[model samples]
Target chain A: MATNRQIVLDNRPDGEATTSNFKLVTSETPALADGQVLVRHHYLSLDPYMRGRMNESKSYAASQALGEVMIGGTVGEVVESRSPKFKPGDQVVGMGGWQEYSVVDADAPGMLRKVDTTHVPLSYYLGAVGMPGVTAWYGLVKIINPKPGSTVVVSAASGAVGSTYAALAKARGCRVVGIAGGPEKCRYAVEELHFDACIDYRVHGDVKSMSKALKEACPDGIDGYFENVGGYILDAVLLRTNAFARIAVCGMIAGYDGAPLPLQNPTLILINRLTIEGFIVSEHVEVWPEALKELGTLVAQGKLKPRESVAQGLQAAPEAFLGLLKGKNFGKQLVKLI
Target chain B: MATNRQIVLDNRPDGEATTSNFKLVTSETPALADGQVLVRHHYLSLDPYMRGRMNESKSYAASQALGEVMIGGTVGEVVESRSPKFKPGDQVVGMGGWQEYSVVDADAPGMLRKVDTTHVPLSYYLGAVGMPGVTAWYGLVKIINPKPGSTVVVSAASGAVGSTYAALAKARGCRVVGIAGGPEKCRYAVEELHFDACIDYRVHGDVKSMSKALKEACPDGIDGYFENVGGYILDAVLLRTNAFARIAVCGMIAGYDGAPLPLQNPTLILINRLTIEGFIVSEHVEVWPEALKELGTLVAQGKLKPRESVAQGLQAAPEAFLGLLKGKNFGKQLVKLI
Candidate 1:
């Protein structure tokens, strides 16, 4: 039996999650069952949504139990297989969690999927060609339903989901505006992601100032918005949205700390005749095949280039995840577990 | 020439609208043109939406110009006509404003429509079988799309739109809950409208208490909401909404006075994966035929009995409208111009 290294949820956070909340443990891998495969993870995808799962409240997904492996997306290779379906050396993607190895049942529904890394990189499977990309497609293409020549705005625009959303909206002939935290990320959003303009939210101390900047960035007013960071950013966006605007609420990283962040003027939603929807990407698995195909093609053709903030080891995932919640990471925050 | 009694917008409102902002005037009726028809107004609809038109800012329709007849929905009879399309004694519905008479173009598109007063009463053209009815149908049927056995909630439950909405949701086999201002209105909603339960929002005091009451009223959790009164009521509803719940935002009368009423927990919108949409009924004119057919049949069969708070004359229009905004009126507030 081989040794497996895993990080488990030690405790729930009071306000902000710290390194003490997670504990590392090493254990012997159990013998393979009749239809089991052993997967050695190479990359662990850390996301802001994981913070929502740490608490005991009912989120979109199940809460992460104490003393259990922290849930995550992973791209890994099948090292051993008892089932004929999955053979050794086959690269796969699944909920492999924050661990070096996972014993998966090959016959289980939605357990794992084999990926072809020839066109797109293996790491991209955890990002632009994977869940985040699909999430952007679902929000932009399905929810927002952007019309050509319309103005579309996104928050946290340099992140994995935001970057893909901007690219997808830009492809549909929309004037894309990004709201990012710092100058570097804003510049990347505008220059690299091909957004028409990017507003650095850090420079604007308050929502009023940020709204002023957003008004300048989108002269025609925002017709659609992909919301990631809630709080003041959402308030500013609400003020600038045009009549009959649509907003897709993907994440509210600001409220994950458990403090209540109220909207100053919810009446704007009625005043502007807006449609705002909050959705979980996993719940919409029907669009995965179509979304992944387009995303994979975009990445392969260099039309959707995703930047990564790679943490060195599995031990760095907690810190990387914490940084992601604070908008410290420029793009997709990943842990190179290999 | 006959004299016309009209109410003009004397001045824009500073905060709350007053009778001083309106001026009653008598003028000689204009001579009929080649495509013209003279309409003798019978009933002038008084609604909360008129409050938005009182301000200089843009509303769903253009602002009512300060020294013109206050724009409103009216049911009337054509007394004279130059065109072959209309004749005397033909009861019609149009934007006839706050006046005893209006000279309208008979050939103009959407200017007038002859209503069947035999099946539905003339006053109902301004309430149950008209714009308010369509507004209710659009929000409840089109937007919320409630499922059978689901719990649907509505605010301003005793008012025109809200009453129709509660009835419609109930007819679809939904468990309907209503939030009304007083004990009388709440009892009326349950007994007259056949709502499963009704909450007297006045007694609840605050949003937290209201939310507690809501949780008790909707034991299975709220699946859909027809939002008429925003502010604390909206906050309370958000707290009790089930996952994937839908809300149709029709009106926010609480904010019409210009006081900022922030939502205390808007993040619940995201947490519960809710879809909230704001819509203007007229903007969706395509659904009018279907909506009106159903509404008219319901009225004729007495399944949708609409109550009225009729003010005496055109001089009573401003006071009636002001009262409507304050929830003083029992049901559809209307001014009998005859």
Candidate 2:
């Protein structure tokens, strides 16, 4: 019998999360039933949303129960298959959790997906051409719904979701502006990601300074905004928004640690007539085909050149994820489990 | 020529608005030019929105210009008309500001409207059938857009906008809840306005207690929220929102004094996947016909019964307005100019 290494939730965090909250255990792979497939994970995705799941409090997503394998997205090759949909050696992507191997019910809808790694690498499924890509599509296409020449801004500009969003917004003929933590990431966003401009939040720490930077970056004022990191960035964006701006609230990593993140000026929301909507990508599966198709096309056309920050092994996942929560990662944060 | 006594904005407010900020001025009403009509106002409407116009800061509406008449809604009689649409003895509504008489260009579309005071009282036009009623309709129908059984909550329960909103929600088969300043206002909302439940913010005092009261009042949780007053009321509502709730931000009287009002726990916005939209009713003129039609029907059917607090004369407008802002006025505050 093949043995599987898995990371399980050891305890819930009181304030800040640490690697001690997770426990790595080894167990024999369970025999697959009819219509099931065994997948040996090659890569595991680490996302900010995972931090929310690790909490015991009620949120949009279900909490990660103690003793259960940590929930995550994984891309791997099918080792064995009892279903007609998947054959042995098929490259697939699924929610395989934080594990070296996963047994999935292939017959269940959306349980597993076969992906072509002809031109795009399999790891992209966990990033640019997969969930994060779809996430960018939903917020930009469905929520923001900007017109051509409309000025749009995104926070955490060098991250996977922001990178995809920048590519998509640029394709729409929008004036894309980005806000990142450091000068290096900001420079990469403008030069590599082709963002029209990028503002370094670290250089301008307070709301007043950041607002001045935003105003200078977006002279026409932001018509649409994708909020990934809230607090000062959001407050700064609100100060520079034109009439009837739309904001898609994707993530607030600052508040992920359970600190009370107060919005400085909700009054600006009324004054500017803004529509701020919060959404989850998994909740909108109907946009998957269309979103993935465009994201795939962009990747194929080289319009979207995604960078990755890969941790060497499964044991490094907790640290990598913790670093990601602190904006230490340069791009998509993932752990190589192969 | 006619001598018109008016209240003009003497100066902008430094903090809380006071009578000293407004000056009682006398102006001559010039003779009606072609397509112009002379309106002798009977009642001048004092609304929370006017408080916003008092500030020099840019908001949804334009600032009330200094050394000019205090801009307000007025219901009056057309004294003379050169335009075919209006004539002598006709009751009408227009933005006549804080004055006894106004020379309006009647030919301008939506500048002046003739109303039938047969079944509906002329003063009701200043409250339920006019801008405030339409404001309520736009927030509830367009922004909130709740289903039949949806539980909707509105603040400023006994005010003109909140009263109308309750009736509209009830007619649509919704469970309508409200939050007002005092126990008297709360009782009036539940008994007179027929709200399912009404919480008194003064009694509850803070977010935690108000949230507990909201849990009991809105047992199913709020599906939609209409925010008229910001601060602790909004914070309390956020804690009791059901998944996918919609919020229509109408006003934030608490912030009109240029104080920085913050939204506590914006993380709840992401957790609840809520849609918080801010709108100005005057911006959506297309919805007016439909909204006004529904509002008029409800008023006629006795489903909507509006209350008003009228001061003796035009000179009392400044004091009456200050009272309205301080929540001392119980209903739609107006100045009887006749």
Candidate 3:
């Protein structure tokens, strides 16, 4: 018998999640069935969207039931294989949950992807070269559809998705303005991401001033808006949006918790002919290969940089997720389980 | 010398506009300029957008200067033509302002469209066949983009734009539900406009309950929302929108006053993948002729009906406009200046 550690959802959270929400215990694993692979988990991705799954309410994705092992994307080494295609010591990325070892059918949809760590770190598979990076890329290029000389505004510009969008938009010849919560992230957005301007919403009194600052920075009013933090930021952007503007509605971290927040002003939509659209990254999986190839080259060419704040143990996953929600993480927060 | 009675802005109101904000003044007509036609205002159109123009602050259109004649759209007779294109006794429509007579240039855009009282009343130009009418048509067909059998919802269903959109969507094989303030309007929306169902938001007490009622009426969830009165109604609709839903944002009658209101909840936008677009009819002048032709044919076939509340005289324009802002006037509010 093989023994491995697993993290299960002990209880659903009331408001903000705490360490008590998760329970870590040892579990016995049986022999793998035909075409099955027993993998040793090495890294786990800690993300904001996972917080939504922890709740028992409705979300874009399915709910993580109470008492089940917490679901997560992981990169691991295959210790045992029952299929001809895989042998021992094969490295792959899969949804292995929060477990030291998992038995998965090799033929399962999205079972695994063979990763080459020579060019990038293994954790890169859980961040920049994976879900978050492509989310920013596909959202900006395909949804917002910015043209050269277009004024682009992005929120949470130091985070994984927003940083990717800012760098890509800059390379595409667009003038990018970013909005973040603190001065440190604001400085990082401007200095490292090469954004034309950055506004610290925490310091700014209101969105109207932010709009004036954005207008001053870009000269041309916002033509494309990559929304990450919704609420006042969205309302202010609505006022400054030019005619025929496109808004890629990405994330609304401001309203994710179960509080009843106020809504955005609606009249701006009529004054400026604006189109706001929302989408999920997984919905565009078929086109991932092309997006990944382009993003990889950009990374290799030093045009795009992947920033990560790696927490060096599975026990730190809760803190990592908490830090991510509070915007305390420097960049893409990840947990290393190896 | 011809004498004209006009409504002038007495003073800008602080919040809800009062009768004291306007004054009826008798003035002598000025001589017409070259290539200009002197129009005797026959049918003055009173619209909700005029309330926005009354403010001293800048809007999509210029604000009404102090003591200036209130701006409005009207159908009139070309009693005195200084140009060869128009002649005396010719009935035309133009921006005649809120007066009995005005000198208009022959070449002004939306300058005039001749009306025949035989098929549809000249007031139809103020209601179903004019700006408000086209607003509904374009919002439903062009912006909302509803598919056959899709669920559609409209706010202020007794109002010109809302009623027209509901009627048109019903004609296109959609399951239409309308939100109105009173039972009378709700009854009319279902019994007359042929909508599948209607919700009286005022009677519901809370938007959540109304949203539940709306969802029950629309078992499949909302695919299209024609937003006329934004605020709680919009927030409720945001909660119930199906994936890939489209919102045609026309006006937020609830926010017409200068008071601060609650912002829209944006997280619903991301979870449902909603597309909310704000548009004005003037932006699509090139396509107006096509839309008008199709809408006129529908009216001629009795598949569409135009509704109007005709005020008796030019001096009554101020009261009519006030009535429109208060939702007192049913259907399209118009002043028959003839």
Candidate 4:
């Protein structure tokens, strides 16, 4: 048996989430049952989706229960195994939550996966080759379905999903543009991520200004868009869309707080003959294999690079998550548990 | 040569369209060139799309040029013909505009189609078996693509497109519900159009009230929707949409008058995983033959019934179109010139 330290949901958010809503707690990991594996999590991923679970309202996923370990993705090493599928030294990825250790039913299909880290690093399974990577793939390939030589844009362009999306679009012969919070991230998106251009949303905060920048960045007009931030950026993108443009909506982090995020002049949908679809990556598991293959290959070839903003220890998870929501995190946000 | 009375766009609307923006004038139908036919219009179809054309802004089609004959669909009889393909007294449907007569290039493919009215009324060609009917077909069959036993909803359910959609969905073995302006139109939708239930927006004008009504009407939740009117209706439907619901947006007449029709809670798109697509039926001419065949068969079988609110003479075009925009017309709004 081992003592496990974790963060739990203390209460639902009133409007916007704060660090006070989370509570750090201690528990003992019980002896493993048959078909169970004891995992020691080295890193816990902090994603934007966790914010939706904190709300009491009905959302795509079930609400996070109070006094429970906060739901999250984790990469770890198996310390002990009662399941035939795993061994003590196996490096694994699973939903290990906010706890330092997890007793997983490894035999429960898809509950845990053993990943090869000879060429790709272990933590990248949490960002570039995991859920975030597959998300960018589905929205770009299945939803946006851009043609070669077309222009495609992604919001939160320097973050996990957007960075991956920009790279994927560029690889597909598209003129990839990005929308990020500030100049530093914009520079990273264009310079490092190989985006044709990136617009700084902080300077062009409103729809009119953002539309002007988008017009300049996408001189041919935006043909497809992967939406992660959905307030003024969405309105601006809608205004600049070419005829028959498609939008794949992955997240609306701006609306995670209770304030209404209204789309100004939705009449543009008709004017532009647009198609806008929303999706959750978890629901579409069929494409994960194909997506992960592409992502893993790119990372191995040094074509797709990864960046992370990691907080130290489990207790820093809440602050790191809050920072992620506020655009303080530069890329994938995570908590180092070791 | 023949005297032809016509309505022309005199000016564009500043905020809301008014009758003063259109002018009535008389013209002489010029002598037909080779491969041309002169038609005497029986009925001119006044549709919501015309309101969009009156604006100077870029849209699916070009703006209705100032001092030119207002664009419209018409059912008429050939009065004179220089083309071998058409003869005098042949019934036809074409873009005859808001005039008593038109000189069309008969040899031009798709410009003029000779339609048989042996089992169908001549005026029905401008409605149930024409552009509006084909429009309803494409949105439901191609976009929404609902399954049997799924619940589909449509707004403006007593109008030309909505009524046809209600009939088509009912035929497809789906639970069909509708929303219209008043109790009378709602009654017509449910009783005459065979809708399972109908909501009256006059009573449920706001999002909260409309949402409650939709919950009761669509107990299984809305699986698909044909969005003709946008505003509170769009907001209410978004709240009640089932996961993976599809919305085929044909028009947003409520926003046509230059007022901002902001979509409240666009975040619901992500929450519900909805797909909303906008289209102009004229753009997809490829589907017309298949759509028209099905619509024609249903109408001839007495399964599809058509209702109209037609104004008399070319002079009434402006007033009738304005009335159609205000939900004053019960069904298909048309101007009868004969």
Candidate 5:
């Protein structure tokens, strides 16, 4: 039996997540069942939503249990297979979690899918051409649905989801404005992602100042918004939204630490006749095929280029994830487990 | 010359509006132009939305300018006509404001509409078969779109909009809940309006208590909410909402006085995947013909009954409006201008 390395959730965070909350363990891989396949993960996708799972609070997905493998998206290769469906050397994508190897039932519905990495890179499957990409597609197409020539603003502008959202909105003839934490990420969002403008939220001292900057960035008031990092930015956006504006609330990274993020002036929601909705992308399975096809094509054509902040080993995932929550990572935070 | 008793906006209120903010002025009714008519107002609609117009801040509609008749919905008789579209003794509904008479353009689109008072009472055109009735129809049918057998809650349950909304949702086979200011209104909501349950919001000391009451009232959790009072009640409802709940933001009467009504735990909006939308019914003109027809039919069949708290004369408009804002009126607040 081969040895497998796994990182488990050791404890729930008191406030901000730290490395102490995770535990690395070595164990022997169990013998394959009748319909099992062994997958050796090459890349593990680390996202802000993982922070939500670390806590015991009610979330879209189940919480990461103590002494269990931390849940994550992974692109890996099937090294051994007992089932005829998945053969050795076949690259696959699934919820392989934070581990060196995964024993998955090949017959399990929606547990794994084989990916063609001929044109698109295997790592892109964990980020741009995968869940994040599909998330952007669903929120933009289904929720926001910005009209041509309308303004759409996105938070966490240089991240996997935000970058893809900006690109998708821009392609639809929307004037895309991005809100980023620093100057570098803002530059990348505007220059590389082709966003019309980007605001460095860190430079603005308060919500009012940030609102002013956002107002300047979006000459026409925001008609749609893709919210990732909520709190002050959301309040500012509420103030700047035009009548009949729509907002797709994807994530509220600011409130993941269990801090109260009260919204001031909810009356604006009535005055502006705004429609705000929160959604989990996985819940909308019907759109996956359509969204993935467009995202895959965009990545293959280099039209949706996504950057990654790589961590060399599985041991670095905890730190990388913590850094991601703090906005330290430049783009998609990934653990190069191979 | 016919003397018109007009209630003008004297000064913008700094806090809560008072009768002093309005001035009863006597002016000669303007002569009918080639395409205009002189209307003798019989009843003026006093609504919660009127409170929003009393402030200088930006609202869905423009602020009522100082020294101008406070804008409102009114049903009256066309005493004089210059255009063939309208004639003497014809019953009509228009933006007749807080006055005994109005000079309106008969040919102006959306300025006036002739209504049948034979089947539905003339006052029904001001409450049940009119704007408030259409408001309930639009918010329920268009925005909330509650599924049959789902739970729906409406604030200001005994008021014009809420009473109509509760009745409408109940007629659609929904389990209807209502939040009213007092036990009297709560009784009216349940016994008269046919709500499944009603919460006396005044009896609940705080949001936590109110939320507990709401949870008890809505054992299945709230699927749809018609938000009329948007302060603590909105916060409470947010706590009690089920997944994918829809809220129609018709009015935020609590914040109309310029007090900050911050929403605590807006994160629930994300966690529950709620779709909250604020709408002004007038903006959706396309639905009027369909809505009015249905509303008129309901009123004619005695299926939708609305009560009125009628103030004696046009001079009583200011105090009635002020009382309406304070929850002093039992039902649809109206001024009998005749």
Candidate 6:
């Protein structure tokens, strides 16, 4: 029997998630079924959406039950295969939760991705080359459909999804401005990701002043807005949206721990003739092939680069998730189990 | 000089507008310039949007300046032409305001449209054949784009714009539901306008119950929402929108009378992947010719009928407008002036 270290949900927290909410324990893996493959986890992807799954609220997905292994995406090598589709030593990606080992059906919807890691790091498959990459692609191309020379603004600029959005919009000849929590991420966004400018929301006095700052930065007014943190930040951006602007509501990190009611700036949508849309990447899985192919090519050609903050071992998963929630992680927060 | 009886804005009201906000006075029309024409008002259209202009607050259009003639749309006859585009005895529709006679530049954007009253009543220009008709066309075809089997909900269903929207959506093969303040209008919307169902919001105890009633009416969930009375009705509709639903926001009568927020359904846009958009008919003039042609053909074929609530004389404009604001008018409110 192989020993598998798993991180379980200990308790649902009040406001922000803490280490006490998670517990780690080592257990023996159960016997795999006829079509199940035993995957040895190499990388775990920590995402903001996991915070939504922590609370017992009705959302896109059900909340994680207490004492159950916390769910997440991961990259792993097939150590043993009961199905002919996957062979021993073949590396793949799947929603394997936070564990050193997982037994999964080879043909599940979110089963796995075969990666040729010679060109890029295998972990990049969990970040820029994977979910976050597809998020930006589908949101910008399908939902927002930004025209050339359009002003696009992204919240949480240096994060995995924001970086992907900025690079993709820039490649399409759009003027992109990013908003981040601090100055360092702002600098990294402008200098590294090549965003036109980055606004430091932490230092900004208030939404009114920030609205003015955004108006000044986006002289043409915002044509496309990709919202990640959706509270007052959304309010500030809504005030500056141009006529017929399209807003893609990707995530609302600001309201993750709070009630989702009484949004401050809905009137701006009526006044400016704007279109506000909410979207989830998982809903468009059938059409995501084109987006993934494009992102994969961009990564192979070195045109798009994604940064990651890697936390090694299953014991570090809780801290990694907390860092992601606090916006401390520079880019994609990942836990390495190797 | 021609003597003109005009209704002027006497004062801005607190909650609901009343006759006290308007004063009737007789004035002489100014001498026409070289490029101007004199118009003799026949049918003055009293719309719900004018209520927004009565208050000294922000809207798409500037508020009525105190002690100034109330603004409105009217069907008039060109009594004298100083420009080649107009001739005497030509019946036309233009923005003649709330007055019996006025001077206008023949080349102005709101120039009169030639009338053909042989098949349909000329006042249809103010309701089904005019602004409301165009509003329905653009908001449905361009904004909402309801599918053949999609479910649609329209508030203020017996009013001009809402009635037109219900008829158009039903003709396009949609499951249409109308929401009105009274049982009489709701019955009219269902029996006369051919809406699939109708909901009387006034009888409902609260918005949550109203939302439940609306949801029961729309088993497939609302795919398109035409918002006329905003506030709580909008909030209820927002809570019930289906994925990828489209909302056409035309009016906010519920919030027009000093309500806190006009439309407060922000969460619906995100949770259901819905799109909410605001529009005005004036912005879509380029496509108005084709739209009007279709509406005219419908009326000429006797497939469409518009209801009119006629208030006699210029002195009745104030009471008629107040009745519209109070939701007392049965259908399209119009004041006879000729």
Scored by lDDT, the top model is: 4
Clashes counted in candidate 6 amount to 0
Q: Judged by DockQ relative to the true structure, which candidate is superior, 1 or 4? A: 4
Off by over 4 Å in 6: A9-36, A62-68, A82-84, A108-110, A301-303, B8-37, B52-58, B62-70, B82-89, B102-110, B257-265, B300-303
User: TM-score for all predictions?
Assistant: 0.99, 0.99, 0.92, 0.98, 0.98, 0.90
DockQ of prediction 3? 0.53
What is every candidate's C-alpha DockQ against the true complex, given to 2 decimals?
A: 0.76, 0.85, 0.53, 0.82, 0.84, 0.47
The list of candidate 5 runs beyond 4 A from truth reads none
lDDT (10s digit) by residue, model 3, range B1-338: 37988888889878888779999899898888888888898888888888878778655556888787888888878889888888998877777888999888887756766666667666676777778888998889888878899999998788888777876887788998988778887888788877788898878757788778877888999999998877777888888899889998888777778754564567777888888888778788876787777666677778678467889997777778888887777787889877
Q: State the TM-score of the second chain for every model.
A: 0.98, 0.98, 0.95, 0.99, 0.98, 0.95
lDDT of 5 by residue, B240-277 (tens): 89999999999998888888799988888888999999
Stretches of candidate 3 exceeding 4 Å from the true structure: A28-30, A77-91, A115-121, A205-219, B87-90, B114-118
- Checking candidate 5 for backbone clashes, the offending pairs are none
Q: What CA RMSD would you report for each candidate?
A: 1.0, 1.0, 2.7, 1.2, 1.2, 3.1
Clashing pairs in 3: A263-B263, A263-B264, A264-B263, A264-B264
Q: What is the TM-score of chain A alone in each candidate?
A: 0.98, 0.99, 0.94, 0.99, 0.98, 0.97
Tens digits of per-residue lDDT for model 2, B83-122: 8988899999999999999999987889889898876888
User: RMSD to the native, candidate 5?
Assistant: 1.2
Residue-level lDDT of model 5, residues A44-75, one tens digit each, is 99988889899898875678889999999999
* Alpha-carbon runs more than 4 Å astray in model 2: none
lDDT of 6 by residue, B138-163 (tens): 88888899899999998878888778
Model 3 chain B: ten consecutive residues of lowest lDDT: B259-268
